[model samples]
Target chain A: MILLSLLGISILVALIMAFIGDWRFAPEVNIGGSLLTFIVSLVLALQVYHEGGSISGSTYFFVDYLNISLVVLTTLVSTTTAVFSRRYMRVEREHGRVGHWRMRFYHAMFQLFIFAMLIALVTNNFGVLWISMELATLATVLLVSLYRTPTAIEAAWKYFILCGVGIAQALFGTVLLYFAAERVLGAGGNALLWTNLSRVCAQLDPTVMRLAFVFLMVGYGTKAGLVPLHNWLPDAHSEGPTPVSAVLSGLLLNIALYALIRCKALVDGSLGSGFAGNIMMGFGLFSLLTAAFSMLRQKDIKRLFAYSSIEHMGIATFAFGLGGPIATFGGVLHMIVHSLAKSATFFSVGHAAQMHGTQEMAHIRGLIRGNPAVGWGMFLGVMALAGMPPFGIFTSEFLILTATMKDAPYLAPLLLLGLTVAFAALFRKVQPMVAGLIPSGQKQLSAANIPVFLHLALVLILGIYLPGFLANWFHLAVEILK
Target chain B: MAHTLAAQINSLLAALILLSAFALLAQRKIMGLVHIFAWQGFFLALSTAVIGFASGEHHLYISSLLTLGMKVFLLPYILYSLVHKLKIHRDIEAVVNIPTTMLLGIVLVVFSYHLTAPIRELSNLMTRSTLAVALATVMLGLLMMVTRRHAVTQILGFLAMENGLFFAATSATYGMPMVVELGVALDLLIAAFIFGIFFFHINTTFDSLDVDQMAKLKETD
Candidate 1:
């Protein structure tokens, strides 16, 4: 009932906000809807906690330990994004970069995007999952091109075509999975249900499952912004509204990885082969190395953070690919922390960009000198993201690296190497921006620093001391995934 | 006798779809690609109807109708209007030459047949042989997208690829669920609209619909 209400309230708010055409009420509605959904999702998480976390309602919705954790993380980030967008988009409107009409569309689409992702998370049917993912893509494409600049259009088009093609391959893979499952579970709806298929997965055709995993990985991997398939990530991130970039990096990419993980669960259950993990690890390591190098040369600050997102996602993917209890725990923890840290970074970056009037790294100087709050927020967020001490990311990264060293000793050094390179590249670009002499004529800091500090504070707390209940839940989720 | 007759008819229709894929590859005019794409859809619809009748899977009849309505009529009309507005009735240039593309398409067909051999052996479905052809059509569409420089032609290739997928679904599994079929149809319509909107933007921005010009977005060395 809570899950249904959450979806209903989001869609309702989106629909109501569509016709109002009033900017003032838009954020109120947007934040209100997100807050309601978050509270409801929190309640759902508690219910799942007490009820042992694996519950399916009929054929459509499934909430397991993994799904509940993701649901909570998604609602939390979206609510914060809604809060941030309220201030950021208003400034955009004041500057005439966004008209009232566009604001309405943006607010509505933001709600709809969250709704679609929620659907994707809770759905048990793979087909519905695909449709929900497609809906999310369409919503984000509009958001990416919201500026209507030529470069923005180009970015949106590339994102659409590449992810579109990639997703079509995933559909083919899903069909193959259905075909394989049909032989064991027998036909109709049951064949495609994750629970049913996973129940009898061992009897499935291994050859078909292997082919399906390849297609699913490539398809969803494109959305996850994995390397080689990640050509569109930097452009999309650089061109869109900063809030959308935050969601793209923080929420949507993680959801895509969530879908991939779900598929991996089924595939692993079926074949009992390590083929899926090997492929994920190969893609993960390559993406990590590639993004680290890519970040070294980035001229745009947003694109720099975009590459960081790819790198962090790669690390998470690598950890998941390693697939032990400890690694899974670390991967899930990394996902949550990365989402918080990256979005917080973008929040500060967004304000800094607005104040400086450009996203170019060279033009912006002494963020802290210009505006201490935004500057300090960026500093702490980047520190957390770069795996500095006393942050959740450091803890998660440490766990993953130690897991890697324990299991595959040879691979640990490469992981360490990639992390080191990225660490150097990010600091090289960021340190001068934050610590230098303040640029003249910089605007005053906007009060939108709440989401940033709030996120960093959470990361700080998690880094220093993870709550017992949440840590327990993370362990349970990891067990379920393994 | 009826079984043999249905099998032959299915093979013949699948062959027509393959031929249309090749025609799309070889065609130079943007308008010609649209016609070829519609023809491929027509043949796909025919094959689905035939298989539906032969196998008595009644849901496939609905699928055939959906394919015909979306692919044959609605999409081509949308693309045609787009072409008319853009005023690009000129010949389409290939990034790769026509002869090479055709040769590659043939190689893909042979490869798909080899790849599907095991699945084909396992299935006793009436349209099993068409599975290889469906895969080939999909590959050919992908190849067309790669070789074409024009945005409209690339859209055509994507639509053709989708047609091949529909054919694949019909042949391999007697079609996806009805709900899924309807959802895919809706998605195709929305994609067409989105592409149409982008085409206008692309034309206005660059004063040309050639996608190669989009490379200006990357940093110049």
Candidate 2:
């Protein structure tokens, strides 16, 4: 019942947003709706935790240990991005970069996007999962093109085409999966349900499952922004509004990986082999190295962070690919901290870009001298992202590295090389921007820095202390994945 | 006897679908591409209905109707009007020459057939024979996207890929759940709508639909 209501509330809010999204208080509504979602997800999380097992509300939807935390993280980051966008978009409006109707479209689409992602998280049916993933892409495509500039249009087009085609492969994979499952489950809607398929996964045909996993990996891997398929990531992140970038990096990528991991669990059970894990590890390491080197040449701050997101996602994917209790625990923790830190980073970057009226790193100098809050926010957020200590990222990266050293010592040096190169690249770009001379006519804007600090504080707290409940939750999730 | 007839018809439609995919690859004229896409949709619908009749999977009948309504009629109408409204009904320039693209498409078809061979051997369904063709159509659609610079042609390629997926679903498993089929159909319609809106946006912003001209976003050295 609660799961139904959560989805119901999101859809209702999306419909309401479509109507009243042009109002002056629409941003407030977006934030309120997201907060309510977060609260309900917390309620759902408590219910799941208390039950200590998966809850299948219906054949259509369910809540498991695997998805409950992601649900909460998604809603939390969305609420913060909403709060940040309230001010950021208002400034854009004041500058005449956005019109009222587009604002309405933006608000409505944002809620709808959240709804699609929530569906992808909780849905039991693989087909519905694929559909919701595609829906999420469509909703965000409009948002990415909200400004409708030549570049924005191009970015949105590339995103649409690449993800569209990539996701189609996923659909083919789904069909193949259905083909494999139908023979065992006897041809009905039950064949498409994750719960049903996983229960009988071992009975499935290994050859067919292997083929299906290849397509599923390529399909979901594209959305997860794994290397080679990650061309759309930096472009979409850099071209869209900063808040969209935040969610794209922080939340959407997690949802995609969530789908991939879910599918991997099924394939592993079916094949009883490490084929899927090997593939994920290969892609993960390659993406980590590629994005790290690519970050060295980035001029746009958002693009730089976008590359960083790929790197972190690469790390998370790699950890999950390693597939032990320790690595899986680290992967889940990385998902949590990366969402918090990356979204927080984008929050600060959004403000800094708005203040300077440009996203160019060379032009956005003296942020600390001009606006200490945003400057320090950017500095700290990037530090957290670069895996500095006293941040949750450090803990997660440490867990990942130790696991790598123990499990696959040969890959440890390459991972370290990627991390070090990325750290150096980030500092080289962010140092002057935060501390150099203030540009002429640079004035302080009343920035919404609370969400920034709030997220950072959470990361800080999480780094210092993994509360008993969260650690327990991560352990349960790890066991479930294995 | 009835099953054999249905299988034969399904195979013929599958061959036609593959031929149309190849035609879509070689066609330069926008109008012709749209028409060929509709024909591909027509063949897919026929194959689906034949599978439904032979297997008595009543739900697949609905899927066949959906393919007919959306792909053969509704989507083609949208693309037709979009091309007319945009006044872009001219020859599309391929990033690679058409001959090379056709050769590449042939390679993709061969690869897909090789890839699906194991699954084909495992499948006992009457429609199993068409699985490779379905996969080939998907590959050809992807190849179309890669070789064409025109945004409209890319959309066509995407729709063709979807057609192949639907065909795969029907051939391999009769169909997905009714709800999922409906959801996918709705998604495709909405995708078409969004693609239409983007065409206008792309046209206005770039004054042409050639995607290569919009190269303003890259790393500045």
Q: With candidate 2 superimposed using the best TM-score fit, by how many Å does residue A14's alpha carbon deviate from the native?
A: 1.2
Q: List the residue pairs that clash in candidate 1.
A: none
lDDT (Cα, tens digit) per residue for candidate 1, span A25-98 = 77877888899999999998888988986877668788888888888889999999999998898888888898
TM-score of every model versus the real structure: 0.97, 0.99
Highest TM-score: give the candidate number.
Answer: 2
Highest lDDT against the true fold, candidate: 2
Steric clash pairs (candidate 2): none
**Which regions of candidate 1 are displaced past 4 Å?**
B94-96, B219-221
Candidate 2's residue-wise lDDT over B1-221, tens digit each? 99999999889999999999999998888999999999999999988888999999988889999999999999999999999999987756654577888888889889988999998898888988789999999999998998888999999999999999998888888888898899999899889889999999999988889888878886566
lDDT by residue (tens digit), candidate 1, B1-221: 77789889999999999999999999988888888888888988888998889888898898988888888898888888878878886656654578988999999999989877877877778888888898788888888877888888888888888888788888888887666677677777777877888898889988888888887467421
